[model samples]
Target: MVTTQRLPASLTPLDAALAAVLRDLAPVQPIELPPVDALRCIAAEMPALRAYPPHDVAVGDGWAMRANDLVGASSYAPLPLAGLPVWVEAGAAMPDGTDCVVDADAVDASGPLPQVLAEAVPGQGVRRAGSDIAAGRTVIAAGEPLLPRGLLLARAAGLDLVRVRRPRLRIVNISKGGLAVQLIADTARLAGAEVVRLKAGPDIVTIANSLDTGGCDLIITIGGTGVGHTDAAVNALARRGALIAHGIALQPGRTTAIGRIYTTPVIALPGAPDQAFAAWWAIALPVLDRLSGRRPRTTLALPLERKIASGVGIAEVVLLTRKQDHWAVLAIGDLSLDAIARAEALLIVPGGAEGFAAGTLVDAYMLRE
Candidate 1:
């Protein structure tokens, strides 16, 4: 079996360090998925074939008319028209040959006949076709996460379906915990990603066979990833391929391992439930987002009530709750599953001191609601 080398703790910030490591390593092999079903495809961006508001659609309930027809029309004395002007309700299509819309609010509609009280400008109240989005323009770029509004926009642009990069994933469960595996599988399912799991066994052939036969785009081996003699998951991965990173300068999940198996990424996590959650949130989640062509965004930091101390040289991820607009430490122990369970955010205090003073500014990332 090949032994693995431990990653050095550089003086860089955790985010920067993680980024540098990721930059040096290539992303895992990609998978193709249907646009309609590619909800969480990594790094996928589709262009708008047709512009938003593809045609001139009305923005309000009003009258559609040729600008010239209303040039001299006013409430003082109404100008007669050839009846080209028609009443169009809000969101109604502009009539053919009509170049403008006069909002009903702008004119007195209480009259038996709708009358215009003011002259309409050339482009007054007109929503020109392709104004919101031009044809053949890229509405969403690669590396942008699909938001709810964005999805709606894509559909509005006439994209019935889209091609998305699959959310390649690796789920490693260590120790004797069955709950961890179940949770990981459930999480992957919710994110629309495929997963692979492994139990604690010393058989290299079984491990290798799992890698060779699986449909996973990434690998996750849980439990045995720490300093224990049975913690050979990292070693096993290195023997199979090159090591990416073996240690992180972060607390609670500092022993996390990142490496490669062929072109697939293998991430090993600590067995503790809280540590596992931290590793997944701080590392795995961002990697998945980057690979799937989505923009990387962290949880927002809420206000803090007290000073918390972190390791002098280790980046700390603190579990906390935003109560009354203040971020209160949910639990001081990194291994506290209760803390994680109660947390709506994971606050990052970069590796440095043994702890944080109350009120120190720290970064925070919000969890999915």
Candidate 2:
């Protein structure tokens, strides 16, 4: 069903070339989802339904009344208790004639009437109508993440649903083992992509055809990109469409491949957990970000305390540990999950450079995935 082909490891393309190819892709159509289900999704656009605190409200426990009523009130000669002060608690609607709130601590509320010990400012202790969020203001802008706080904002604005840009994604692990697929699926979900898993039998041709036929925005496959006889992903992809990139210079994931069947992108990652995770960020995450209209992860330049060794012509990946005010180099080549869990960031030694020396500056990618 499939045949093996191999190329020397040095023949792989540069990492920048692969990244350029993935950047040209565009986002897919958006989907409507309730606020609860839209967590971490990319927002299409959010026009608020109603203003937060649509009416003027009391923001403190005390009486709500006109500020002018306490113009001469003072502690030395406090305003005597009136028949009664309009009592209102926090979040209660202020009475029609009230323009300010006298804080409970600023007045004596124990008695039937209230006594003011301080002058009341016009806006003190009062949450005016639409004060936090104005009416018709855009709450969620285009390409912003629908985080928990954003959901709360939506609820405050009287919105029960939101529109998010979520592309359909399909994952297929060429190997019989399923761990690689699980890792890929987790990463995809983190990027807010809707994942659909496809179970392919041992037939490589069947696997290839099924992957190419799916309408998903992206297709991800694990294993079968190496040099062994069983490594057949390249051939399978070649049977359908072009393999844009066969390999990348980055360590651990040198054999990662990218292909396209018409408009949908297909990514083939290594079977090893470390390699798979690294490639998922270095390669797949960027593609997903572009398609969903989300900004790429921020990169921080930090100083390394120890020398990190790497090749000049090959792209090298190094992990960094957080030290006091700076970072320590932990270039075990490519980091495993457990090692990365302990590390603070992933540093990159580009194909243009050899490596970084101790106390030198290195550009590192933050742990965003």
Best by lDDT: 2
Distance from true location, Cα of 333 in model 2, Å: 2.2
For model 2, state the Cα shift of residue 99 in Å: 2.5
Scored by lDDT, model 2 comes in at 0.77
- The 10-residue segment of model 2 with minimum total lDDT is 1-10
lDDT of 1 by residue, 126-188 (tens): 777888777887645766545565566666676666655565555645567766567566665
Report how far off residue 244 is in candidate 2 (Å). Answer: 1.8
Candidate 2 TM-score over all chains jointly = 0.88
Clashes of each: 38, 0
State model 1's lDDT: 0.64
Number of the predicted model whose TM-score against the real structure is largest: 2
